[model samples]
Target: MATRCDAIVIGSGQAGPFLAARLAAAGRHTVLIEREHLGGTCVNDGCIPTKTMVASARAAHVVRRAAEHGVTVGGPVGVDLRAVKARKDRVVAQSVDNLTQWLTNLPNLRLIRGHARFVGPREVKVGGETLAAPQVFINVGGRALHPDWPGIGEVRVLDNTSMMTLETLPEHLVVVGASYIGLEFAQMFRRFGAQVTVLEAAERAVAREDPEVSRELQSILEREGVAFHFGVRGAKVARSADGGVHLALNAAGVAREIDASHLLAAIGRRPNTHDLGLERAGIATDARGFITVDDQLRTSVEGVWALGDCNGRGAFTHTAYNDHEIMADNLLAGAQRRVSDRIPAYALFTDPPLGRIGMSEAEVRAMQKPALVGVLPMSRVGRARERGETQGFMKVLVDARSERLLGAALLGIEADEVVQTLLLAMQADLPVSLWRRSVPIHPTVSELLPTLMAQLKPLEEIPR
Candidate 1:
């Protein structure tokens, strides 16, 4: 027998629980189905757990450099990998418990724990039960991609999820990508007293960013003894007779081999849309299997929509939550909102984090439009000097005619939080002149923004 509901939410990721709650609060019968843990990837493996471990790594880094700050420790600084994993587990468990409790107690909402598959239009099957609703929402998140390299099945390899389960640190950790995930783990393991080496097929790290940004970030990581090999190709993995991992890599037609204690593949991620039986429901997906959706996040099938990493619109936690907001406002609140209306913003959670919003300098230059540009080094920031953690720079671009902020990137201490101010101004379509005239607090990294705006100049070729 099919159970009729007002709304059916599949995969309790960042979007499902909240959207289901909204439907239930509106006096509609709602069913939320989750195949995995509550709070999806963010709580289980992605943001929450990774950032918690990042914090521990930062603590280890700080203690190692305590001598420079005139603080003395009685003994040598060392990180217990087991203790770090325990702390991360506690943080993640607490979040999952809280979210699960709230969803369980919510009125008029049923929580189903099983994999959901589309059976027909506006209907899904989980376990032996068929759930039919007028509105169907899919919020299934993504997972780390395991490359089908030769000999991959013979040797054990760690992805992002498996990396969190380490009790003992590796002696030599070889990372297979120089992307965000790979770089973060490289530095984290290095700080924990492991020899870290990163391999990237591209010529630079984070190829999406400006060339200078990539070079500078690579330089920062290299300074910490994190080895990097770019332009790598023809990579293969194998198990050594001595119970170790062996990697053979080719760069510029030259073969290179490395033996390491552990290997982590952090190349990319893919949506969890393959097994959902979308073909049964006539739902459309991209070539890469991401559910296709309009600007309003509407899928091809009527009364069905996809959110979170499944939709391929945006993958971050904040963006996923915002997706629920956009859809709920349009459907329940009788307002017209769109995913495109929001500006793109995200952070790379390195020790000296990278906060970026809007267009990159390369993007602006590619447009060939007149633009006002500003650049400032973290070494010049008062707060960075006080903390002895200066490693990056800030760059901003504005429309020359309107003086409106086009984009900004802050890569220094506290850049993750401080960049929000610029995001707000850009969201409001405010002018840079307003920021230049405003007085900002002293002894802070953000206080330099006003001064940076004051130095806006005509765009020119990047310095040699």
Candidate 2:
């Protein structure tokens, strides 16, 4: 016999819990099934723990530069890896606990602590119980991708999740990917007194960014004592005699070897839908195993939906949360919110973070769209100059005809928060002139936006 509910939410990721709460509040009997921690990746491994450590790293970085701020500190600054891990653990625990409490108190929601698998079109198996629900939402999320490299099985390798658990700092950390995750960890560990090197198979770090942005970021990280090997091929890994890991790669047909105390495989992430028995439920997935869904997050099977990284639409936590909102609005509020309506945006949490929204200049150019471009260096920003952190620049793209914002990227201090202003402008369909004329608070990183917009030039003026 199977226990039945009105709705079943799988994996307690960003989307699952919020959707479950909405269903329960709508007087529906909802079951929220979680195989691991209640708050999933964001609270447990991805955002909370990593950002907490990044904060510690930032503190160390600032303290080391205290002299620049006219604040004389003690002789030398140091990092205690154990203490850093402890603080991250506490932050994760608090977030998980708060989410667990909220879920437990939901009146009509049942929180199941076990793995779930689809047993039928409308039924799932978890533990010794069979649960059936007409409406099933899969938010199983994703996990770190493991590459099949030589000696990978023989040597100890760390992924993003396991790296956070390391109690001792590595003397030399070799990162396998130069994406956002790899770069963040590279900088964080470097600040923690590690000699870090990053290897990327792509031609450049962050291949998706504009070439100039990629070069600027690489320069910044390189200046911070991080070595990078790009356009690498035929990479192999092995254990050295001293028990350290050795990575050999071919760069432009030349063989090179790098020995490091630890190896972090920050290649990418994969959807966690392998063992879900999607075939039993008639659910379709793409070649990468990400569940296929329409703009409204609807799966092939009626009354079933997939959200979060599992669906392959957007992998960020914010996008996952927005998926829940879209589902709730369409299903419960008689609204037509859609996944396609969202403007892509994300932030890299490096010291001088990179905040990005909409298309990149390369992307716009690829579409052959007429664009107006503007750029301002952090050196011109009063606040960045005062803070002595002027290292990057801000760029904005506008439609040449409408003067409407097409995209924006801020790669300087407080960029993560400052990018939101342009996001809102894009969302509201505001013209570039409006942003140019708007009076922002003086002496702030964001206030430079107006001045930046004042420098808008034809896209043809952009240096190749």
TM-score against truth, every candidate? 0.98, 0.99
Best by TM-score: 2
Q: Taking the tens digit of each residue's C-alpha lDDT, what string does model 2 give over 4-89? A: 89999999999999999999999999999999888878999999999999999999999999988899997899999999999999
**Model 2, residue 157: what's the lDDT?**
89
Model 1 over residues 300-356: C-alpha lDDT tens digits?
999999999999999899999999999899999999999999998998888788999
**Candidate 2 lDDT:** 0.92
- Candidate 2: worst-modelled 10 consecutive residues by lDDT: 246-255
Model 2 alpha-carbon drift over 4 Å, by segment: none
Q: What is the lDDT of residue 214 in candidate 2?
A: 91
